[model samples]
Target chain A: MNFIAEIDVMPLKELLDPQGKAVAAGLKNLKLDAITDVRVGKHITLKLEAADKATATAQAELACQKLLTNRVIEYFTFEVKEA
Target chain B: MNFIAEIDVMPLKELLDPQGKAVAAGLKNLKLDAITDVRVGKHITLKLEAADKATATAQAELACQKLLTNRVIEYFTFEVKEA
Candidate 1:
């Protein structure tokens, strides 16, 4: 089975996002005055070929813990769907 | 108008993804032997409250350039849909 997973990695809320901040400031230039709290993060979509959902989830969790996140500065989770 | 945007940010291929590397190694524990090239990145879904579609795209792009990417190490783009 193949699963499609969407993952997000963001700095903790308490942490400052320089990129997000810069983005917010730039939006101000374009007259997007309604925009606020423009937090920025990364998104990744992966195709995981596993024998089953359990295996796929395990693979995803393992991926999150071992390679997908810094745990110290970032966090991640997946929305798994059949592919 | 409101827009839903999906964003992805990843390290340039030349930059090593330590977390991605660690994740690949961990998948080995799950018997996912076929899995390879498991690069990791972040995903963010944004709701841009704007007056029009063109404005929404510009806001989203500004968000990417000024906040979302670290040009030295990362890059990003968006998938915009009507909301």
Candidate 2:
């Protein structure tokens, strides 16, 4: 079966996100005062061939752990669905 | 009310995502041959003050249009929920 994995890799909440802070500051300059905070991360869409959902999920998990994220600073979550 | 908007900014399907292609190559080198394709994008989380969902959604949309995306090559989608 073919599957699609939507993966989100985010900075650990305990850590400061400079990019987010910068975006918030830019928003304030734009007079978007209502926007109080911003956090930016990576969203990845993967299309792959797998025998089943479980296999696809496992493959995605491995990809996240091995290449998609920096474990010291970021964590990842993913959902696998039929393509 | 305080609201959170989860926004995804993606490269247009017609555009070539060099970053995505690079990741796919890295995955292939890692021997994850089951994965056939990858697309990388930005995921943004926004915290804001708004009177209601509609207001929050509108704020997010405005942010996307004004500062978060390059409309010529990318598009965005968002979901707003109570924070």
- Candidate that would win on TM-score: 2
User: For all candidates listed, what's the TM-score of chain B alone?
Assistant: 0.93, 0.97
Q: Which ten residues in a row have the lowest lDDT in candidate 1 chain B?
A: B30-39
Task: Report the Cα lDDT for candidate 2.
Answer: 0.95
Give model 1's TM-score for chain A to 2 decimal places. 0.93
Q: DockQ of every model listed?
A: 0.30, 0.89
Report the C-alpha lDDT of model 2 over B1-83, residue by residue, as the tens digit.
99999999999999999999999999999999989999999999999999888988988999999999999999998899998
Superposed Cα deviation of residue B5, candidate 1 (Å)? 6.1
Query: Across residues A1-83, which tens digit of lDDT does each residue of candidate 1 receive?
Result: 77867678777767887877776677678666656546677665556888888887776676667766688887776787787
**Clash-forming residue pairs, model 1:** A19-B67, A42-B42, A42-B43, A43-B42, A43-B43, A66-B23, A67-B19, A67-B23
- Predicted model with the maximum DockQ: 2
Query: Where does model 1 exceed 4 Å of error?
Result: B1-42, B45-83
Docking class of 2: high
Which digits, one per residue and each the tens of the lDDT, describe model 1 over residues B1-83?
Answer: 66777778778879888877776666677666645546677665567887888887777777777756688998776787787
Clashes of each: 8, 0
Q: Which stretches of candidate 2 lie over 4 Å from their true place?
A: none
